[model samples]
Target: MRDSFHHRLDVLVLQLARMCDLTAVAMSRATDSLATGDARLAEGVVADDVIVNQTRTRIEQDAQTLLALQSPVARDLRVIVTVLRSAEHVERMGDLAHHVALAVLRRHPDPVLPAPLRSRFQLMGSIAVRMAGTTGKVVRERDPVLVRTLDAADAEMNELHRSLFQVIGHRWAFGIPAAVDASLLSRYYERFADHAVAVAARTAFIETGTPALI
Candidate 1:
């Protein structure tokens, strides 16, 4: 009986980790659509959000069910809580992806980004996607060292985001539209990476026997 219960619990955790990976991929697609002005890709991203929402709901339900049925203790309890929190992170990541798609749709086929600004935005998005993938890996493997490595990569994204803002402030010569759009895209990428880092930190805590602040 004990073994079966833990087996189910591990399956649930793995499912949530997979959901996080799917959301990260969706976010990457959304950013690509934005950078390339690919209307088809943007539309595809918007359409695929249904899967993200459904997966999040199912993961939450599973977490609740496990908690109620098993009355888990210690590490089991921590795993349940981590699964719940990770679901939220994955759902929010999907929302960010949709927002990026909407930004692309809003701009339509027109070149929505300035050359220099788009270049920087692309760099930021790439880093954010990579960090998100790392977060998923950390959760799946329960590796504290891998999580810490992701944390470092996340710091680089933060620096890039800050530098992007500085460039926007100084590049007044590019006019208001350029600065505003660049700022919006940078904000999205920054928030995405921040959430990824949070996931990594939380997963690290769960795996390493560290206390969760939540």
Candidate 2:
């Protein structure tokens, strides 16, 4: 019985890690769709979001079952609880990617980003994707040190996000519509990084018992 219960716990952790991987792929493809205005890729990213959502649901269900049946305490309880919270953050990351893809679809043949702002948004997306990849490792290993790296990544993303406003406010001649779209898209990438950071923070809390605000 103990062995079977332990196996279930392992499965939950693995599922959470796998979910992170899925979100990373989503973000990458979404980024590509945004940069190139690929409607088909954008649609695919939007469709795959259901899979990400389903993964989160499965993780939550399995973790809850373990909580009820195994009566886990101490580190085991910490792992399960943190897994649920991490799953939430990771899933949100997926949603942000989906939002980015939807923006691409909304714009259709017209490019979503202006010429000046395209590189910035692309960099932000890259940071988000990197954070998601690292988050998977953190989820599986629960390493506090690895979480710190994600923290650094989130900071970079924030800087890039702020830079987007600088362009739109002064230099942008793309008019209000384009500016608004850029602002929202920048927010999406920023939030994507934020969610990745939050997931890593949860992994850190598993070890250090620190509650991260972001």
Candidate 3:
């Protein structure tokens, strides 16, 4: 019974890792769709979000079952609890990515980002992708070192987010609609990175018993 419980716990972790990978890919593709104005790619991100949601539900149910049946103690208990919270963050990341893609889908042939801001949005997307990748690594490895690195990555995201505001502050040629879109785009990416950082922080807490400062 003990071995069975451990095996189930390992499976739960694997499921969480899989969810991270899916979320990361969704963000990458959503960003690409945004940059290129590809409706098909944007649709793909929207469709795949169902999978992310289902996975989150499964993880939650499994965690609850483990708690009821196995009554995990100590680190095992921490792992189950952390997985529940991390899954929530990961799912939210997917939703944010979906919103980015939805903007592209709404605009269709027209680019969501104005020409002047395309490069900025591209950089924001790149940073978001990197953060998502780092999140997956943190989940799988649970290395405290990698967890600490999320702070630096999140800082870069903040800087990029602020730059978007600066672009909007000056007399913008893109007008109010474009400015609104740009603001929404920036928020989506920023929130995406924030969730990734949260996942890393949760992993750090699980491993070290010290909560991340955020």
Candidate 4:
């Protein structure tokens, strides 16, 4: 029974990694759609969200089942709890990516970001993708040192998010509509990074038993 429980735990980790993989793909295509005015890629991300949502549901159910059946205590219990919470964080990352895609669809023929803000958004998207990829690895390995890098990357992402406001501030030539779109897109990237950080923090918690400030 103990070996069976451990096997299920390993399976849970793999499932979480799969969900992270989906999020990374969603965010990557979302940025591409945002950058190139490609409505098709944006639509594809929106369609893929159903899978993300389903994965989250499955993860949560499996965690609950393990809790009921295994009656795990101490470290084993912590691992299951972290898996449950991290799944929600990953699901939110997917939703943030979906929101970015929706913005692209809304402005289909027209590009959502102004010329001045395009490069900034691209960087933010890159950071988001990197953070998400790292998050998946952290979930699998639970390496404390590996998780700390996510904190550094998230700080960089926050700075980029802050800098975007300067461009979108007063003396804006693109008008109100563009400003709104840029603001929302910047926020999406920021929150996407935040969720990635949250998942990493949860992975850290599994081993350290210390909750992260994030």
Candidate 5:
């Protein structure tokens, strides 16, 4: 019974990790679609949002089951708690992707980012992808050190976000509609990165037994 129960818990963790990967892939694709002005890709990303949400719901249900059945303790309990929280963050990340896809579809029946801003958004997407990748690793390996590296990555994201604002405010002169769209897109991307950092912080806490906020 104990062995079977432990196996169930293991399955729960793996499922949660898979959900993160799916969410990351969706976000990466969404951002790429935006950068490249690929309407097809944007449509695909938007379609995948439902699957991501389902995966998140499944993870939450599984976590609740494990908690009720296994009665995990100490480190085990922490792992379950982290899984629950991480799943929520992952779902939100997926939602961010959907938001980007909708923005692309709305702004560009044939969407293309302004040339100057493309590279910056691309870099921000890269950071978000890296965060998702790192969080997956931390979950699988329980590596506190990798989580710390994710913290450093978050710093770079902040710098990029600041640079984006400076560039947009000074370099481009857009009409009101374009300006509003650009601003909202930038904010969404930055906030997505922030949530990724939060996931990494929680992973680090689970691994290191320290709740050091990043």
Candidate 6:
């Protein structure tokens, strides 16, 4: 029974990694759609979100089963609890990606981001993708060093988010709609990075039993 429990735990980690991968892909494609005015790619991101949701459900059920059947204690229990929480964070990241795609779909051929803001949004997208990829590594390796990097990455995202406001504050030719989209898009990317940091922090806590502050 103990061996079986460990096996399930291993499976749980693999499942979480899979979720991270899907979320990363979604973030990447959604950004591409926004940058290029590709409605189809944006639609694809929206459609694929169902897979992320299903994976989260599987991770949750597996963690719950481990808790109920194995009665994990100490680090084992922490691992299960952390997995449950991290799954939610991952799911929320997926939703943020979906929101980005929806913005693209809503705007269609006419790019949601203003021409001047395109490069900034692209940079934000790149950072978000990098963060999502690192999140997968953190979940699998649970390295304190990698976990710390996530906090820095999230800080970068916040800085970029602030820059978006600065851009909006200046003379804007794209009008109110563009400003609104830019604000929401910036927020989505920031939130996506935030969730990635949350997942990394939870993984660190599970490994070291020390809660990470960002």
lDDT of each: 0.79, 0.88, 0.88, 0.90, 0.79, 0.90
Better of 1 and 6 by TM-score: 6
lDDT of 4: 0.90
lDDT, residue 103, model 5? 88
For all predicted structures, in order, the TM-scores are: 0.92, 0.95, 0.96, 0.96, 0.91, 0.96
lDDT of 5 by residue, 67-136 (tens): 9887888778887888788788878888988998998888776554666778888888888887877777
Winner on lDDT between 5 and 6 is 6
Q: Supply the global lDDT for candidate 5.
A: 0.79
Those runs of model 3 whose alpha carbons end farther than 4 Å from true positions after fitting are none
lDDT of 1 at 8: 79
lDDT of 2 at 169: 78
| lDDT: worst 10-residue window of model 5 | 107-116
Q: Which one wins by lDDT: 1 or 4?
A: 4
Provide the RMSD of all predictions against the true structure, rounded to 1 decimal.
1.9, 1.5, 1.5, 1.4, 2.0, 1.5
Per-prediction count of colliding residue pairs? 0, 0, 0, 0, 0, 0
Cα deviation in Å at residue 113, candidate 4?
A: 1.0
Steric clash pairs (candidate 4): none
Q: Ten residues in a row with the worst lDDT in model 1?
A: 205-214
- Candidate 6 regions exceeding 4 Å error are none
| Model 3: pairs clashing at backbone N, Cα or C within 3 Å | none
